[model samples]
Target chain A: MNHNLPVLVLAFPLLAAFAVNLLGKISKKHVAPWTLASLILSAGTSLWVLKDVLQNGKFSYTVGGWMAPYGIELVLDPLSALMLVMVSWVALIATFSALPSIKKEMPGREHLFFSLYLILICGMMGLVITGDAFNLYVLLEITSITTYGLIAMGKGRAPLSSFNYIIMGTIGACFYLLGVGYLYLLTGTLNMADIASRLPALYESPTVATAFCFLIVGVWIKMAFFPLHGWLPNAYTYAPKGASVLVAPLMTKVSVFLMIRIMFSIYSPEYDFLMHLGIKNLVVWAATIAIVGASLIALTQKDFLKMLSYIVVAEVGYMVGGVWLANQEGLTGAIFHILNDSLMTLCFFLVASAIAYRTGSSRIADFRGLFQKMPLTMLALSVGALSVVGVPPTCGFFSKWYLLLGGVEAGQWEFVAALIFSSIVNAVLFYRVFEVAFSHSEEEPSLKFENSRILETSPMMIPPLVVIPVVLLVIGLSAGPLVREVIRLAVPAL
Target chain B: MDAWLFEIIGKFNYWIYVVLMMTGFYAMIRKNNLIKKLLGMNIFQTAIILLYISMGSKVGGKIPILDKEQALAGAVQVADVVNPLPHVLMLTAIVVSVSVTGVALAVALRIYKEYGSIDEDQILERIGKS
Candidate 1:
């Protein structure tokens, strides 16, 4: 209940990561349990923090008791508390699944892998919890740096992937820093709340306008928003499955959260002159092009991971477009879709991991007769695919429903069309994989590649199947309550 | 003499910072060699350090000293004080930036070990062959 819970959520993983690094040097056996325990504890802390935030009002805890605008501060309101719970909880599931996969994919780097993994989790938690602007840039670096470490642990083309990631990520952070410099020059403040308070008086300045553009562009690069997403497909494709599943599911979504905070809270909707700077127009068009362009590109990829990478490009569009609509339904949809997209991508990547584990390949062609060998895995993939396609009763459908409604309310039928178009493209792309998995390959002549690997299942599939369906259900069943709260907070601004 | 040197040093530091930052960015983008790219990253991060230290300067300013005499005298005026806040913040930022560069270099070393070449085009060719 104390505001210290927010700090604890970050501190536990960070300390555990350091301990795990030490323990790992002595004996690798301790790495798995230590990592799991640390992550699960973080998840528990987030849940408790969420409960406290809902029961109480917004609470702030200054790091080192230095007070706001001077000392660093962490705040737990509904938005951040919910994000912490989702991220840490999902991180636990991902870590649970990471164990066997990491052992197989990267046998030598268990200690470094888990330590970097926890560091990344700490960074994301810091990004969500901290109320300081410049501090957010520091936290963003923490996550980005750890992500490079994780990706570098992969086997094939990993270094190059990490290199590309480093280049893009450094540019993103630089853009953010430059923007922070502009804000400081104008307001001479570094705190988000302080900046918000001061920005209104300087709303008409070209510097403020420039600052907002840099900040948005920086966040967009971090999120891998389209046209700036050149680094993503290769990075995700080459990274170890353990790291890919963790990052591909959550990192961009967290960056998107920062973008939303910058847009709504720091910019403060009441500033009429700044609000007229045409950010909404820029976001809407960027999202529109991303949705159409990414879907088209995804349709052409033959590699499994590469296809999923392109799909991520499309998914970013869905979230960004929802935010730019600037209406209740749109914002609610954007918020709720963050959950849906995370779970859906988790399901997708987990299935990709399973397929790679069995066949030692990630090519779409490798999926022929997959259903015969791995029935349960295929079924999980089907659910993930259905969700991606926005099929009814799944979480993805509800997300798209809200997004579409938002678009219509904003009189942007073109965006609604783009959403539907992407969904249809998803159906086509995933169904092709499905059809291949269902049928026997015609290439084999005399002897069939024996289905000797009975079921071809792993210990990793359990958490994903168990949790992903429930997530889908929760999105549908709890949409009313989630939307209500989002409306409550956002209505005043609108 | 101290004031004159401080003015010259403060302005000179900024030019080096901007040039180094640009150099690092150029090498990172222009070169195909992974190790050189990491060297560039180190330079880029060094530029941020210079920026922070520049922000910390105040002409004829003393280091932050807390004593009963100074506090009672109220001698810590804005004009006579260096802003140590940016320096402290920069200290944290420097540690993080170095750690990042360390990891990036580590990854580059691993890449060299695996592919037998740190050149991007050569590595891509090897992967394509595989």
Candidate 2:
């Protein structure tokens, strides 16, 4: 009965996206509810897959009943199971909040908005599940193109940013495709598991070395690792509110998952070139600079949404540094941080979406007396803010702890310093927002929210904002069991 | 000297791809005009497609189609057919590149509409003044 779950999880979204577009022509109000029903169904299937993977161990589903190497397959394991559930649920919540914003921002075009939205989700899920290298590239482009369309829907400077995204995204995808081409030339296979089995024999070959370089660098560009992150902040910050909320959270995180998948799964754990060339340390060192520089830049941004984009860049550094630390603790920390970071970033971006919905602004100075006007929203924002600042009993704190330990274990003092420095900088960044929010209340107490339901935003937006912070806390508290039961299985064989 | 010349000639296809791809790469980074950058991107994608097509070629090989009667006779040889995998992959890739190009052109049109020009520096100047 559950055998078709993997393909169903992917196929449902593709079908729902088109269905939503068609339904939009008939009725505007139906788009969000229709999309929600389908999203919930897809999220449930993802959970079922997660449960199945946890129980029976890893399984691969061959599409169209064809065999592997000749046919594409979806592999569900503990890592992908974690990502699938996290991304699907977060996407559902984001879509829910997006309803109010879309109605306000782009009223007549609701169907097309949801259509691109659902396709982006499909691309991300497909990126996570596919076990074939070439299939991964195909899915990545689907995600990228949908993302470009979605970002182009933003108001002022969006189209230009979308064009910039097209350039960088195509280059990244092409580099990845070229790498896969070289791999096929050498290994004569495209299935990831087959490639891994055949690769050790060619490890010393220059062809294999070049292929590895192209593939990982391509993924780095996608994830916006330090030097390659030029397109991310401008593209995301200028994107429409709804697009930024979802893309800001899932896009880079999924790319990081793909990076991990490629490095450890397709190449085997003994990818000793990092050690032989000392490039692992070089990667981690680069990550350290990304953390420091992004945090400092984030601090200077007056626009809250733009600041969050830089924080996303810094968070990318955390995961990259942790993974490249090349130890069990570091790897576990990196994988755990992906889940933690996605939830928190979704929380943060959702609040930004809500802010844009209400005041029609996310400028920090424009938020005068927001604490009094929208107390609940500010409260939710604080939870997100504190998590990013690495406060305890929040999920971010635990992930940072593990990452710091990993840094120490690897004896990388520079990374250790960068992590601490960024956390402190993040604290200052959020506190400054709070200071501005509270600064106005002392003198004029802005418009009092005696009937604050207006401040609460539409009823549709509140549920996601309230529910996400609670989940953040729950995930933080249960992080221990999560590592034991789930993350341990997900870490690389290395 | 003869062997050296022959080896270089044998790898001529790869050298051509490298040259074409680099030309595109240079234009993408060095050009200030948006349309030129778009053209460069197209060139870059076309070069990669050509690289994949060349990889599928064989001097003595025919098309990759299988003969039904020859299969029944059990007399098929692998070397007789050029590799079809890269060709199939590149076909899908060409479609993707075309979609990317379409989206990019649409965005470029929008940029021109909004800012009245696609020169990177002028656009930035307009954005700054606003």
Ten contiguous residues with the weakest lDDT in model 1 chain A: A445-454
Candidate 1, residues B1-130, lDDT tens digits: the string is 9998887676897788779889988987888888788788778777877776777787789887667787789875766778777787777877877777778778878888888998999998998899
Give the clashing residue pairs of candidate 2, or none: none
Error of 1 at A393 (Å): 1.1
Give candidate 2 regions above 4 Å deviation: A441-453, B1-4
Q: TM-score of every model?
A: 0.92, 0.97
Report lDDT per candidate: 0.83, 0.88
List candidate 1 segments past 4 Å from native.
A272-274, A441-454, A485-492, B1-23, B66-68
- Model 2 lDDT per residue over B1-130, tens place: 9998887798988888889899888888888899999899988888888888887788899887889999789788888889898889988998998898888888898999999999989998999999
lDDT tens readout by residue for model 2, A1-494: 27899888877788989999998999997787778988899999999999899999999998999999789988998999889998898899898788888888898998999999999998899989999999899899999999999999887889988888888888888889889989998888999999999999889898888888889899998998888998998898888888888998999999999989988888866867855537888999999999999998898899998899999999999999999898899999999999999989999888888777777788887778887767778889999888888998888998999999999999998999999999999999998989988766666644333344574776788999899889888988998998999999999876
lDDT of 1 by residue, A1-494 (tens): 66467888888899999989999999999998888888888899898988788778688889998989988888777888888987897788888667778887778778988998999999999898889988998999999999998888888788788888998898788778768767876787788889998999888888888888889889999999999998899999999988998999999899888888888768877766434537676678789999999999999999989999999989999999998888888888888888788888888888888777767678887788788777777878888888889887777888789899999998887789999999999999998889878886556522133344535656655667667766766776676776676434533256
